[model samples]
Target: MPHPCALDPEQVVEHEYVGLLDPELRERIELWEEELLDAEDASAGPGNYDSYEEYEAAMGGGGPEGDELTYQHDLSIAPGWKVGGFASRHLTDPAPVVCSCGAGMRPLLTVHGREWDSGTLNWVPLEDLDVLRLPGANVPAGVYLGRGLMCVFVCPADPAHPHRLSFQ
Candidate 1:
């Protein structure tokens, strides 16, 4: 369907819309970032440990290695093109994205620069395994939106209502 103001370009106005995030989920994500940062800081240099397993063992084996909390958080919010899914608030804190009609907007589409990154390798489709080994396999499209994702939110109350755009 066409946007509400597709025919009238001037009718579409620019405004800021903040995304909403759960406090508990935000806390968990913060913890995850901290853990990753700690791991990076603890590393002496390349070949500091023979392998990831050795590094984990040296870190007391209590961080993100096979951690349920990390897995759950990562799994809940996926990266890449998607429809009707949770948005990734990796770059900023979440706030509500409200429609002009006063209805809460729902995520309709999300565009990303790449299908998956090092941290999100779990999201890669099994069918793409053969291509995954090739250079630039993760980045099928060269599109880049700063350093994060761009989500388009539509008003559930009325499809004709203008949709909002969010960059996170």
Candidate 2:
């Protein structure tokens, strides 16, 4: 996908956060997390990928860890997960993002620098820090969301349409 026109903070529009759920929401999310952790396998799971040699062993030889260490980011949206938040990138349009199809855009993804910023357990596993910090890892080919929320937006009219990425 192509990047949006390079825009200044003043040039682009903005939006406010409006999805603060009730206190019960946090309890539900915690319950869900516990269930998920219990249901998943010990080794064959997120943030726990075997090496090439281990993969080869799992295929035909004895399965075990290998020299290379591979990891996957934990998808569990921890307690801090919020909705309808501002962009978090150091440099990017704020909000009120618009689509090329002449329609208002909505958020598709909110890429935070950390699963838990502070004052709580770091839900983001240390093993996945590299993936989170790497520029363009979650954004477009050239665009960078910096160390904040890289909120990716999509056209509400059509899901297949191109997306718009912005940082706050």
What's the lDDT for all of these models? Answer: 0.64, 0.45
> What's the lDDT of the predicted structure labeled candidate 2?
0.45
> TM-score of predicted model 1?
0.61
Candidate 2 structure quality by residue, lDDT tens digits, 17-79: 222334576566557666655554344344333577665554333322122211111222231
Instruction: Give the winner by TM-score.
Output: 1
lDDT of 1 by residue, 40-93 (tens): 656534547768888676554645344433443354566666777766666777
Candidate 1, pairs of clashing residues? 18-95, 19-94, 19-95, 20-95
lDDT (C-alpha) at residue 81 in model 2:
21
TM-score, model 2 to reference: 0.33
Report lDDT (Cα) of residue 83, candidate 1.
70
Models 1 onward score TM values of: 0.61, 0.33
RMSD of 1: 10.5
